[model samples]
Target: MPDEIYLPMYPGEDGLTATIRVNGHDFTGLTLELEVRARGSKNPVVLSTETGELSLDLPDGIIVHYGAELIEALPDGRQTTIDLFSVSGTARKKIGAGYITIGHAGHMLTASLSIVEVPGIQGPRGWAPLFAAVAYGDSVVMRVADWTGGGGDKPSVGQYLGPDGLVDDIAEATDFRGGVGLTPDISVLSTATLDAGQDADVVLDPDSTPEEPKLRFSIPRGEVGRTPDISILPTTTLAPGQPADVVLGPGSTPEEPKLAFFLPAGAQGLPGAPGEPLLLVVSDTVDTGLGGWWVTRDYHAAATCQYLRAEMLVGAATGVTLAVRKNGATVRSGIALGAGVTTITDLGLVLAKGDQVSLHREGGGTLAGPWVMMVQIDGRAP
Candidate 1:
């Protein structure tokens, strides 16, 4: 029943890490339990004891609400809740303003955190990019800020986090509490620091698509950071566990953005733009196996083909094996592969299938796709 402090953090950002100094083996024969919670639901909680590598993979669609509270039964049999409960980012708050800016970092960009007024949470709302449109070594930086920041500061506050939307700046909020002819109390939760170089700068793959954008980030198979917000829209919504990626080009390309996810058949509902097919990489960072890594296939390599497929995939230590399927039936197969001299793995597929293309490979055991994430039909349809 004592007081506790909750520290909120966002993904792709830093999380809370504290060192616990245990005196000599004085406490050897005791059992300790650590409980983690999500979304106010006390029903099922994640636990860890004697930590070496602590990890919690929450359900795909659910936002992570976590706290580590140590429970100890005193010698007298009374249970106590330790104040070790501190919450940080694995996800974002429900509502508020967020921002990201372009042309920062000497045109070298940087990103920062902005927590404005949110409906349910304490500070204001926040925002993150669905995927990293801007890569590291590029002038464009990304961030989460209030929508009301000065126009000049907007770009400074924005970032390409492979996140979904921007947070609204409350500085522009219209407060009704003020009497007639009063200015709104509107305030932004931004640090206005516009972090650069350290922790904020993003790195892009040299061989990514030039046409569309993929927000790339590192998903700690067991690591975590504080980038706690996302944009929700009627047309599109970005969520945790949904991979996001980015491509940094010395110059921009003409690629269009894409979206993909596990749906319950009719769940995709109807495409916002029916006639046009969509190809999207998950906003969540892929956990390539042990030593292996993944990067976007270099367009130059595929440019020689009649049509090219500049695809993205997260590789595992062993190398990814891919299989192409058509209309629910297996057709062609290829190794979507791990990082190497290969620019980007070419599905070498001809579109014509429209949006019927599908890709898949969940890295735990063996690799399997239905690996065709996107099947681009030849623009010159017969």
Candidate 2:
């Protein structure tokens, strides 16, 4: 019951077909209002009430975040809403022709807003610049109604079998075919569904059986981060010396932006000895190739791959240090706070496989504003 659920199997329920004899069809005469809402969205598209059903054909690239509803008008003119995912039987089918449906108390709702997959997008120019994002990260989040079934508000991301018939966290799946029966709680049947994750590489096999494959998957959103790998996690340690590098802006544009990180409080000071010299910088591109010199100040990589490192001061005032070996011996020496922005290669070390990373400051230490200043750490992919 987390905000997301995994559906390795289909239609959470077994032996349940598209139609169910719910409450003796009393809902057939009742007026139903259908609505769909994307997660984190303020808008909801109300489909229909007079017909007790609705079909939608929205343009591609729009992600249906979370939640869909079915409302019915009461005799007193009041309305009650039911989750579309949990609707059962014909009551569910009435929402969309080929989406998954569920019924509760004779009420049915469907989820079949087709996903528009933008295939074969490549080359230097694209909606996004990264080739990894263009080729590998592309995938679909499908919520469809099968001619007989398909039902779920949101697809269960990070859930599916690999081509090797094993549970893979990296394999891409393009389809979660079939119509599912919904439960009142908005959960999907696991038997016939696939939730594709980032790095999802897939090709739907042609169905040899009569059912054929029925799916609606579109590439709504791409993973903003890259898969953390061996190169990202170096084996050598990164030692911190002093002057935790942490400055966000210059390009910390307010709109169309995102940021997260911690910084020192005052201009100078610390808890145990002095805090680590941590640097976090954002750039339009990452240092290309191995041993690529990193921007010393802002340690986090932005605008490219999702690779980043944090530094801390080890021994207080020992070396102009950033990250200290709190428990681990890994350290990043120091920053050369020059007249302007300094790209100190020696200061910014590559992250080692066993190396530990974190802010140098101990518990109650100098706040960034209290000591230095607030630094920005944009979470951009390498």
Candidate 3:
């Protein structure tokens, strides 16, 4: 008798037949009793056969043929020979690592298999197995108890749902609410609609009395060129139509003090000081027909003084050259004056006793209009 035997049986086959031998002889004419029993069961199947070629109808489960061939019977009435050393497929193959064979109805399915790790199993001497870790693209969703804990048949104590693997979906309500406090650090937020309650415009109450202690005035520290002289006045309450006296403090003197009193209407004003007359002379309008150059009325100095300013005005838009001459010799020349414009020139010339000052113009192009001249003088009479 061979140590192992395999039979290619299918779900729709008639019956499996195998030859039986004893001591290298065809053991004929013998009543063979076959007993089928599931593992861990006390009851044995009761059946018998009466031929050396043993033929027995088997059900789906683990069964022993002639106490040698281990048969794995599938639920669909197919049986295949399985043992420790080899498995029976359409052809016989050896059992090896990283592979598994499953007995099915009409086929023996073989697949590549791998064990990542064996988790620690609790024993009498504590956990002796190695701990496992989740691999990429894989996750452990639940934990099962070991056999040491009351036969390992208890319900799962806990389960874990892995991180969200979905993309492009609305956030959970809790997550959305929690994100209200999140602000982007580097990015600018634009085109966002804000609630009316969040508007930043604040109205201050004008009628409410302000406490002095709550009022703060600050000047920021930087280059303000110079420290300004500021004076705080004493608090004063004035009645209606009552005038307030503002006294000038010591350090609060202005560079130019402004006169406060107004002159009465129709009051005659006194003349200016001797050397500072308001106006020396203003010439009447004069016309220069299309000439290249024309001279104005001669101005004789009445006082030995300095000529301060001379103002010339023309009526039409034409270019003109102006010159000031003292006794036929030119004192200033080549001064271009535009027509229809008023030109003011500061002379600062010291006129001696009886000095002659005259004005001349050149190149008045067809401008038939009046020219007016005004002079300002400062000093004493000759």
Candidate 4:
């Protein structure tokens, strides 16, 4: 006997068979019976030689065969009862039993139905599916044993929905209106005086009427007037050796001041008096067409002469030869001449108040036209 047996079918089609054996020997020559109970049926369908679904062949085996009519009577799942029995004289004994699982022919490709020459008893059937009564749409329906009904009052205006999904109207809200009007009246309340150290400010006056407030402005005294410009005119000479005096002029104004300096020329000069005037004289021009010794007109001295400068001009001359004589004596001589004016100073020559002075000239080489000589003399009164 096998632990499980499978019978293959395609609902109403069949040609399946199985052989029976007992303890490895061919089962023979006894009253053989096969009982098959289809799924969900209360009674088993019995088969025997009397029903022609089981055949007996001595020396071979007893065969249980499935026919089209038998497969049509069974469903596509497990059977609740499948058992084979043998009878001797009047007592029946169970010989083979196992689970009979009936399924579609496609499921048999990966399954095995090892129907050995033996017999088997049937096994427990599988469980069935569960069902429940439920409904849906807008509201829910369920089986409630002891629940009663419910009721509530309707909602009014000025209401709001709450967290529990109920209309609430206990709390109310208020509305607001517009504002008041004002006029455009403004004026100065009072003036504020500030010290030099304080900063200038402008602020509203709180003590004035509420309907029209006033503004107060404060300013520090103007900075001290810019320093006046003071200027003194160039010092004036009053007298020699006297102290200088300052005199205010008529041009003084609030913005500028003008003062004149009356400085004394100072007490009369103490001792050194002025000397006699410097005397300069040019001898009359004499153009010498040739070289020669020339003489100038004699000059009488007005004051004693101590310093003397003598110069002469010659044209086309090689060198100079000139002289100054006082009272017919050569007091200064040996002065030279060149292309331009030639000057010489003589401090050694002295002339008295009535002495006479004269210039002597001697030309060398080619002396041309327009030759002249000049003399300057200065000294104190003797």
Candidate 5:
């Protein structure tokens, strides 16, 4: 074997034989020793028949074996070094050496060897194509291998793969135009009414057999209830001076019930005391020759008064004007008086509480002596 002998081989190849020839004669009775590794890797892998990586045909050749794991570990464009040695017990002798180049299968094939012709082998007779079919039950009866019409009635019967491979279905029929050999039936069996307040139930009849099943509905009857009796009665009375109100009382009787109302009355006021006769007096004596007016007397009414009237008495005067004012406002005026008494009846005035009344006198230019006037007002105050 040459030291520089280079043999190219691919990864993942099995049963590859390399003849171990020494001067045209087989190297017999020699135990195989082989070392394989990537070209530059320090760790080397050993191959032998004991390791199950290679097997030896004694005096013939060495067969190398590889798998997908070796193919992945050794890549294309990287080289593997292989060293072969013959071993007899502990003695080892170096034999042929070479490089195994891992590459694709056809990467190193020569043009002449690439297209080698292969001879054909004889085979059995071909099968004829299908000719006719017809619907029988769920499946169709088909006739095939009838290319030569030797016998007209004799036909092969079988099933075929539908477009999606389901049995007995045809590809050309999109809708169901044929029967499926069965029909379902449904009907109501019975209906029963139960008493009120029971649960409603619906059951399927004939539990042992599923075909032609019937439904049974159980319903409950509704009952009419009694009407409620109602009544409003005034039963309790409240004393006077209490807050006035109406309240609902407890019902009377059990079967024929009645509702009662208790009403309280408001307090009644006492009759007012007899109206008292009230008199408010205003009196003054004035002799103003300069013709000036004087408010003689004023009085505020301490209580409400009604039915008012005024009386005035003048001793003497050359000329004078007199008027009665309520709260400084004139309510009665133009009372002509020279002497004696002048009465103004039906004053038609009501004096509210805190009302002030005054007597005003204006003297004329010829006013003589002291003008003496006394006025009295009367009303009923309540």
Candidate 6:
């Protein structure tokens, strides 16, 4: 084996195939040692290969291919190329990272080679391409330092870097340009002033002690065909030592506020003003004689009135049928009074001025004593 044998190769391209001859004799199954070293690195990566048939009649030679698995084991940094060599027995030959070297007898062969660095396999956190693909317009959100008008600070209104790498000012206003503070003199005006041609300014002074402002509102005076409905207004304040006089407008009558009161038991309220007088047209009590039906009495109304009430008393009889008629026709009927029962019926009948009202009754079974029947009519002008 020679002390040092140089063999050219490429780093990032196809692996190299090396053929070694064993002096025209079969040396199959012979173990060979392979050593690889990256340029400028002291530590060398090592592997092993076995002799195999290099040609039909050259079974004594061995073949070796340089692959990426060996190159990736190098440290994470830059390297110009990798230097590799193999040793069989006492013979040694140098092979570049990406080349095919064939050795015969004492002569060595070399070829230009290429070497490529494979990126390390990583999980999400170690992905560099993912972070590189993200740009400003890609809507990638990240928590960054707050803007402080310093290097790499977030862009703000009127502050940006131009295409020429110079700091340029943006003319548009930003939402946060205003400082964090309220105005000292803030004035509020009613929208109604737009049409009324009146100006009302309510100023707020932040530096001084808070005080209420005086406010007054009124409707214009005019002759209105109908009264306008009352409206609710917001609470207003009055200035100190300010006198306010609230006079009712024309045709406006203010009534007394309703007072809570309780009426005593059986207390009579004040009678209302005189209305149409009520007259009793019929008032009579008679017996429903024996076992026969009879017409008790008839009364003609001279003025408009209503049938006010009727009282019937059946005396020791099974039952008594009492009825009332208007203008000789039955208007009210089907009133049955049980034996010894007294009942009062109030009828609300609107009668013209010339309507006649009559009372009739029939005794059930033989009525004893007098079955008193009384009917009364009012003179209400219905």
lDDT of 3 by residue, 1-382 (tens): 1222234433333244332211222212323333333344455433334332234232211221332222332222332222211112343322211322235455433322122211222233332222222222322222222223344344332222224522222221112112235442332222334444453332223432333112222223333233233333332334322432223443444432211211111111222222332232322234554322344333343433333333443234356556656666666665555433232334434454456556565555433333334343334221
lDDT of 5 at 220: 89
Q: Candidates sorted by lDDT, descending order?
A: 4, 5, 6, 3, 1, 2
Model 3 alpha-carbon miss at residue 90, Å: 74
Stretches > 4 Å off in candidate 1: 1-278, 286-318, 340-355, 362-382
Query: Model 1, residue 206: what's the lDDT?
Result: 46
Cα lDDT tens digits, model 6, 1-382, are: 2222344333323454444333334434434344555556577656565422122223644344545555454334333333444355687655324433333334334433332211121122321111111123423222222244343333433233333432333222122223556534433322222324344444433444334333333323333233223221222224322322122333432231111111111111123221232321221223445432344333333343332333333224455566656666666565565533232324444455455556566435434432333333444321
Q: Which regions of candidate 5 fall more than 4 Å away from where they truly are?
A: 1-23, 105-382
| The best candidate in terms of TM-score | 4
Query: What stretches of model 3 exceed 4 Å from their correct place?
Result: 1-286, 289-314, 339-348, 363-366, 375-382
Query: lDDT of model 3 at residue 67?
Result: 24
Q: lDDT of each prediction vs. the true structure?
A: 0.29, 0.29, 0.33, 0.49, 0.47, 0.37
Of candidates 5 and 1, the better by TM-score: 5
Model 2 Cα lDDT, one tens digit per residue, 26-142 = 233323334544334466545443333432222211112222232212111222232332133455433311223333533333333321111222123322111111122444323
Could you tell me which 10 consecutive residues in candidate 6 have the lowest summed lDDT?
258-267
Tell me the TM-score of model 3.
0.21
Q: Write the per-residue lDDT of candidate 5 for residues 1-382, one digit (tens) a residue.
A: 2322234444443543333322233535546666666655567767766666666554544555655545554557555666676666778666555555555665441100011111122233354445466564465544332444333344343434344432444433223235565555767788899999988898888652456768898998878554334444554555533432323345545443444433232222123222233333332333543323444333344433233333332225544566666777777666544544454544444555556656666434343322223343544321
Global CA lDDT computed for model 6: 0.37
Error of 5 at 170 (Å): 99
TM per candidate comes to 0.19, 0.15, 0.21, 0.24, 0.23, 0.20
Model 5: lDDT of residue 135: 62
Per-residue alpha-carbon lDDT of candidate 4 for residues 1-382, written as tens digits (9 for 90 to 100): 2533333333322357654433234455557777776766667776686567877665446555667655665676644456767766678776655445445656541111234333323333333222222233332222222212322332233332233332333222111222456763677876777877679888878865657778798978766545556554554655433543445577887456665655333122112332242433332323443233344343344443455444442224456566666667776666665555443333455544555566565545433433334344445321
lDDT, residue 242, model 5: 43
